[model samples]
Target: MVDKSARTPAETKDAGVLIVGLGRFGSSMALTLDRLGQDVLAVERSPGLVAHYSDRFPIVEADASNPEALEQLGAREFSVAVVGVGTSLEASVLITGNLVDMGTPQIWAKAISAEHGRILQRIGAHHVVFPEADAGNRVAHLVSGKLLDYIEVEDGFTIVKMRPPRETQGFTIEQTKVRERYGVTIIGVKSPGQEFVYAEPTTRISSNDLIVVSGHSELLERFAARP
Candidate 1:
């Protein structure tokens, strides 16, 4: 393991995150966390991956499936750890179990399928992510030609960007009564050449305007599907 620097135990415990595996999912997480200014220590079993990212991140070539390797690298110092090994279910489970045994406060594991997610949760993973599955679902929603973008904030709630329907165009928000009729809230609007602005009760919608709306997933889908 490569020691980046000397840090107090409290600082390490409070701020750092340990990320195991450097495949597509793991690498993406590391890059995003780094961009967000979070302190990250990455571990990958492949020497090539470790070398490719070492100059950009604090990474080490280590098999995190082995508890001993994690112990030697002081994995317990991290308050949160992410197991991004999706290719091998066995390796993924082993790493997650190791982190749980070490009493990591928050564990996020990637799951390739529903069963894999269940096992991770049963083994004490605090959060289970299905990146590929979620991406596919999002794309499926976008392909309908109405919703430009869709994000499910939770089980039922969603926020979407879409073109204003004909009924909404050429009318102010208050005039359209969209919220009253459609059960969705227009949070913002973007004109053809202007920056996105917060939606107001009197904000007028044009045929070319883009709107951001938030509501239950079903309601948002219905609103977007409107002509």
Candidate 2:
């Protein structure tokens, strides 16, 4: 894992955010920022949404993917920029790259997936948003059967407590270092009458037991798919 450096200081004196793409995400985020008393400039290719939110937001009707349009909007003067284009990956890439090149104080982009997110990261996106995948997990967990628990965390990680596999039952915890392999840590566990205790490397998990785990977004899928 690359060592993340401390975040740069927020531009307290700079003007409010400049958002590209007036789709659902752009309008929604712009509205929120406007409500927060920040000056918000929204750019949109859609004339419909532009008219819809122009009165409520400071909007510039233009194709966000165009660097010339961004320059016309004076986006370089904003404290932050959000590229919220969905569907068009090429447009998203171009707009985000232009925003970074323009030296927008901060650039936030909505990514389609982990792989796509990596590409954006390489191109200078300050952060990747995965709202759908995250909300899906929380919604799916509500309909779960027998699974004790699950919770979502920042950057789309999950915490789960579920039963161990029958094949792995009776084996000492040390025999299988799940934490090392799965990139998740077992936080705690409960086995019927046994007292619920936080998990340790030496803690043996039995068959038909509940194991609390914390892991990355894909880690939860691995556990749920386990036979």
Find the candidate with the highest lDDT and give its number.
1
Q: Report how far residue 137 has shifted in candidate 1, in Å.
A: 0.6
Model 2 over residues 11-48: C-alpha lDDT tens digits?
32366777888776777898898898977667777777
Give the TM-score of each candidate.
0.92, 0.60
Per-residue CA lDDT of model 1 for 99-213, tens digit only, reads 9999999999999999999999999999999999999989999996699998988888999999999999999999999989999999999998899999999999999999999
The residue pairs in collision within model 2 are none
lDDT of each: 0.90, 0.73
What TM-score would candidate 2 get against the native? 0.60
Model 2 lDDT at residue 186: 71
